[model samples]
Every structure is written in structure tokens, then in C-alpha cells.
Target: MRNLARPLLFAFIALIISVILSIAVGSVDISPKDMLSVIWNTLQGIEGSTQLASTYQTILLTLRLPRTILMIMTGAALAGSGCAYQGLFRNPLADPYLIGAASGAGLGAILSLSIQWPASSFSYLFVPMTAFIGALLTVFIVFQLAKVGTTLPVTNLILAGVAVSSFATALTSLLLVNASGELRRALVWLLGGSTMAGWKPVISQLPYALIGLIGLSVLAYKLNVLQFGDEQAVQLGINVNRTRTMIVIFATLSTAAAVAFTGVIGFVGLIVPHILRRITGGDMRRLLPFSMIGGALFLLLADIIARVLIAPQELPVGIITSLCGAPFFLFILRRSKGKDW
Candidate 1:
């Protein structure tokens, strides 16, 4: 426990700094002083009594705050699920998207976008709902395909994921090619740009994220036990099949919620947990929470770069993460070549 303290504290501090930077460094910079004044005024129940301009206050409250919170949620969801996947499979390379969840979610989102639904509150619910369903279905199919007489081999799982993900990607492309509504927006989303802004997405996604993250945290001990192989885990009094199912369901829930809103941001889960595993050891008890914090810090910093890298012409946050994550992924792949993770 003592060994976990310093890294956790450092991660939290970094997350705080990233959150501050994310809120402050947007197009119209809001200084720390003005931000504090706005917060203080709001806390005092003195609306419109701040020295800061109204535009700054509105941006802070309506735009940056929700977006920052959303990013943190998305990051935590992805990284927590990724860590769980790695533990469940006993494979260090496993990621949230490893089993076709992202591709399936993308297909669902594109399907929703292809329709010309009325601009109503209910319309906001369709995309995410469909996306979540698609993700669950994809995972189900992949699980069935990968199972070998009641056992799921890591190699088979990866292969099934690739095949199913490829098919889903093809379907998504076909829809995008023929779609008549919101084509550009759909394209941006496919490339990992956020389309939905403001608080609605954050609010809608919160419940799913909470269920998934908290569920994974609760099962962290089971994940550690499962690392010893299915037979061993069962002998140790763990219900291997049930635990595996719960992990998958929880991971898919979090991954689908994140992908439904944030587009298919890659490598966050793959990168964060692997790094932390090396630093803190492979104990899932500590790895899950640390990965959540590290993921939030990472994505917040990536988002800050996305906003400022081109200045006024913001690139997708996914692009920034891919740029950084791709090389790190390659390095890990090389290191793991010829060895079982």
C-alpha cells in the first residue's frame, strides 16, 4: 500500500494540472484569477457578480467544464476496461477495442447518422443506444467464434476480433459512402473527432461509465486471480466463466459508452495500463485505479494539444493520441516479440 501512495499522488496532481490547463488554454484564454472569481461568485450564490466577462464565464461553465469532465470520463472508461481486458486474457497487448467493440460502435453510430431523424431530445438518445447494442453484439459474436470447447484462447480471441472488426469496418464504410446526412461530421467522428458538445453527452454517458468502472474496480481481485490461468483460478475458488463474463460485460459497457461519444480514440487503454504495469507490477488491484488516473491525465494533455497544435483549426484529439501512441505501441510489440506477456 505504501508503494502505491507516491505514484497515485503524482498521478492525481498531474490530472489536476491537466484539468486546469484544459479549462484555461482554449481559444479565448481564461486566466486562473478570472476562473477563481467565477467559481467563487457562483459558490456564493451571487450570479453575475464576478469581475470576469460574461463570455468567459459562459465558456467556462457551458463549454470547457463539461468537455473536460467528459474527457476524464472517457479516458477512465477506456483505460479501466483495457486493463481489465489485459488481465482477463493474460495478454499485455489487450485493449478496449481488442474484441471489435469500437468497430461495432462505429457501425452503429454511422447507422444512426444515416437516418434523418427529427431534431428532438429523443434523437440524441438513438446514436448511443444503437452503438451500445452494436458493441455488445460484436463482442458476443467474437466470444463465440473464439471459444474452443469452453476455453477461449488468447490467439483465437485476437484473430476473431480482427476478422469481426474488419467486417464491421467495411459495413461502416458502406454506410458512410452512401449516407446523405451529416457526412462530414460522420467522417470526422470516424477519425475520432467529437461531434456532440455541451453537457448532454456527459450526462447521458455518466451512468454507463459509472457502472462499468465501478464494476471493474470491484472485480480487480478476481482479475488478479485469473492471471494464473482458468484451471488454477477455478481451483482457487474463483468462478472462471462467470468472472470472465462480468469483466467482458463491464469492459464493453465502458468502451461502448466512450466510443459512442468520443469516436474511436485508439491506444489510450493499450498505452496507459502497460506503462503502469511495468512501474507498479501486474497486480490488478492497484493497476485498475492507477490506469484510470493516468488515462485522464494523458487524454487531458492530448486534448490540450489538439486544441492548440494548429490554433483555431483544432485537430481531433484521437489524432494526437495516435501520433504519440503508435510509436509506443511499436516499441512494446518489439519488446514482446518471442515472449508470452
Candidate 2:
């Protein structure tokens, strides 16, 4: 308990600091004092500000706040799901994107984006609904492919993910090629980002994120037991298949919601849980919470860099994560190469 408290406390502080820095260090450069003032004023319903105050307030309310909140939620969801997947498969390399959830969501989001919806109400729900359906379906397909009678092997599951991911990627490319007017926007979104940040996305993602987080946390102990293998877990009174299904469902929900709203941000799940596991140990109970906070802080920092690294010209957050994550993933692979698959 003491050991867990320290990391949790540290993660909380880091997340708060990252949020403040993210708000303060954007293109227009609002100071921390001003950022806090704007938040307070907005919360207290204090309207009207000086010209300078109004400019900062508008940027804060209209842009940075929603962006940061979505960033935090997206980060937590990806990292939490990643942590759950790793525990479920007992594999260090498992992640939502690597396993086809992101690819599936990407395909759905693009399809949604491509369609011209006449009703404004339908427009709001269309992309997220399709993305969630796409993600769930892809994961289901992977699970079916990976199953061998009663037992599901992790290696087979991974291979299935690779095949499915390739197929999804090809389809996405075909769709992008045929997309005329929406080509640029679809390409940018496929590359992954949160530039579309707004209250709408925040509201859209909140419920799914909460549901995934709560569901995963509840199943953490079962995940820990399943790490001992299916036969042993069953002997110990755990229903391995049922737990795995629940974990997959909740994890996919979180991952799909995130990509549906913010595009597909990667390496978050891959990076956050692995690093935290080393520092905090393999206990999912402690690890999941830390991963959530660590993911939030790490991605928020990445988003901040995406915003200010090139000044006015913003880079996609996915590109930044790939730059950092790709190398790290390679290193992990190389180090773990000789061990059992």
C-alpha cells in the first residue's frame, strides 16, 4: 500500500503539472496565472474581460481547455486498455493499435467522415457509432481467428492481429484514394491527432472512457489470475474466457471512443504501461491507475510538443508518438527476442 501510494501521488502531481504546462505553452502563450484566472472566471460565470483577458479567455475556453481534457481522457483510455491487454495476453508487446482496434476504428471513422449526413443530430453520433462498431467487430474477428477449439494461444492471436491489421490498412488506403473532396482531412485524421478538439468531442468520449476505465479496474484481479494461464486460472476458480471477453470489450470500447473522437493516437498503450510496470511492478491494481495517469501526462506533453515544436505549424500527435514509440518498441523487441513467444 505504501509503495503504491508514492507512485500514485507522483503520477497525480505530474499530471496536474503537465495540464498547467500544456495550457500555458501553446502558440499564443498564456501564462499559468492567466490560465488559472480564465478557468476560475469561467467556472464562476464571470463574464466580460479586458481586451487582453478576453483574447486569452477565448483561446483557453474555446481551444486549449477542451483539447487538454480530451487529451487526458484519450491518454487514460489508451493506456488503461493497453495495460489490460498486456495482462490478458501476458505479453509485453500487446497494444490496442497493434492488435487491430485502432485500424478498425480508423476504417469506421473514415467511412463516417466520407458520408454526407443531412441531419445535424445524426452527424454528431455517426462517426463515433460507426467507429465503435468497427472496432468491436475487428476485435471479434481477431478473437475468432485466434481461437483453436477451446484454447486461445497468444502467438496465434498476435498473428491474427497482424493479418487483420494489414487487411484493414489496405482497405483504409483504398478508401482514402477514392475519397475526392475529403482526401486531405481523411489523410490527416488517419495520421492521428486532436486538432478537431472541442466540447463536442469531449462530451462524445467521456461516457465511453468512464465505462472502460471502471470495467477494466473491476476485472484487474481476474486479469492477474489469468496471467497464470487458463488451466491454472480455472483451477483457482477464475473463468478465464469470460474475463478475457469482458476485458476485450471494455478495452475496445475505450480505444474506439478515443480514435473516433481524436483520430488514432498510438504508442500510448505500448509505452505507458511497459515503463510503469518496471517502476511500479506487475500488480495490475497499482499498474492500471498509474498507467492511466502516466499516459495522460505523457500524451499531454507529446500534444504540447506537437503544438509548439514548429511554432504556428502543428504536427500530428501520432507522428510525435511514432517518433518516440517506434524506437522504443524496436528496443523492447530486440531485448525480448530470444525468450519464448
Candidate 3:
């Protein structure tokens, strides 16, 4: 209990601090008093309150609020997807990127946007739908390619993912090469940014995310069983192939929905689960919830840095995470002595 208590307590505090910082620190920099007034007025459904200045209110609603929600959801989805991939593959190095989910989604976004698709219909809404479909298709194609004469092999799945990701990346670069005004926007979406997300975007993705959480939560114990080698897992009566395929599908869907809604946010998926697993002893029961909290908080803080580091001119959230995550990844590698990959 004491061991479990620490990460949980730390995560809770980190989340509280992140929310406060996200609300209080922004371009306009609202005072805590004014911040409260805005929250109160917004929650109370009153358009204007003497306590809330209109400028501050706009800053809160239009700028900071949407970005924060986008960060949280993106972070949570990535973290959860990373956890699922790592557990299913029994490889700490595995992430959504390894399976071509992110790359494929980015490609889907680019293809949909580069064309003159209806902004109200497909470009905005169905671009993500296309991305989600692409993610699933990538996974399915990889799975099919990986089958070794009727048996789905993990090794083959990984190799296929690598091939597809490389191909998708090349295609993305091609789109970037032959581009113009709105095409530049498409590239930005591919590179992944949270600057444009808002209430409609958030609401659009809510159902997919909620469904993913519930589905993965139910399969958490099975994921743990899979962490044991396949023979052992099968001996324990878990369907190794089915579990792996389902986890991949569900994680891909969650990831696609999130990436489609926002863009390609990274590292939270790669790092958060490993961090939680260290303190929590690799139990899915514990890892899932704790990872979600930690992921949300991690991105909340990272997004704040992206906002403040340049202040008034936001850095891409993906860039900030990469800068932080790349180093931590090396540290993890060193700690492992380059073994057990």
C-alpha cells in the first residue's frame, strides 16, 4: 500500500498544479481572482460578470481552455495507447509510432486536407475519420503481413509496422513538397499541433475516447497475463493472439481518434507508462489509472511550457515533448544496460 500510495499522491498533486498553472499562466496572464470569476461566470452560464473582465474571459475560453483540454486528452490517449502497445508486445520500446498508427494518421490528415474537401464536412470532421480508418488499415495490413502460415507472429507484425510507417512518412514528405497555403496548414497538422483544437473538436472525439477507456480497462488483467511469454500466457488460458490483436485494434482506434482530433502528440505515450510501471510493479490494474493521471499532468505541464517558453508565440506542443522525451529515453536505455529490448 505504501509503495502504491506514493505515485498516486504525486500524480494527484501534479494534476492540481497543472490545472492551476494552465488556467493562470497564458498570453494575457489572468490573476487568480479574475480566473476564478471567469470560471464562475462560465460555469454559472452568465455571459458577463463584473468580477470577470471580457479580455480575460476571452483568454480563458478561446485560448487557454481549448488548448488545455486538447493537451489532456491527447496526453491521456497517447499514454493509454503506449501502455497497451508495450504490454501487448511485451516490449518496453513499443509505442503507437512503432505500429505506424501516428504516421498513418498524419498521412490521412494530410491527404484529406490537401484535397479541397468540404471544410465543414470532410476536411475538419472526416479528415480525422480518414486518419482513424488509416490507422486501423495499417494495423490490419501489418497483421496480415505478419502471419507466418496461419499464426500471427509479433516479430512479423513489428517489421510490417516499420515498413508501413516508413512508407507513410515518405508519402507525408511528398505532400509537404508539393504544397501551398492551406497545404502548409496540412503540414502543420501532420507535424502535430494543439493550437487549433476547441470545444467542437473535444466533443467530436469524446465518445471514441470514452469507449476506448472502458474497453481497455476491461482487458487490463489480460494484458498483464500477456506480459508473460506466450506459452505461459496460453497455459494460463489467455488467448494470446486474440488479446494482442484486440489490444492493437483498440489502441489504434483510440490513437486515431485522438490524433485525428488533435495532431501527432508524442512521448507521453512512450514515457508515461514506463514511468508508472517502474513504481507500480507492472500491474495493469494499477498502471492504467495511474498512467492516465500522470500522462494528463505531464502534458498539462508540457503544454504550459510550450505556451510560456516563447510566450504569445506558441511552440508546437510536439516539439516541446520531443525535446524533453528524447533525453529521458536515452536515460532509460542507459539504465537498462542496452539489454531486454
- Over 4 Å off in model 1, which ranges? 49-52, 332-340
RMSD of each: 1.9, 2.0, 2.3
* lDDT of prediction 1: 0.85
Q: Model 2, range 33-144, lDDT digits (tens) per residue?
A: 8877887888888864788888888888878888999999989999999999888888888899778887898788778877788975565577777887888889889989
User: Comparing 1 and 3 by lDDT, which wins?
Assistant: 1
lDDT of 1 by residue, 243-263 (tens): 988998898888877888888
Instruction: Give per-residue lDDT, candidate 1, residue 282.
Output: 81
When summed lDDT is taken over every stretch of 10 residues in candidate 1, the lowest stretch is 45-54
Clashes of 1: 0
Best candidate, TM-score-wise? 1
- For model 3, where is the 10-residue window of minimal lDDT? 117-126
lDDT of 3: 0.77
Say which prediction, candidate 2 or candidate 3, comes out ahead on lDDT: 2
- Looking at model 2, the pairs that clash are none
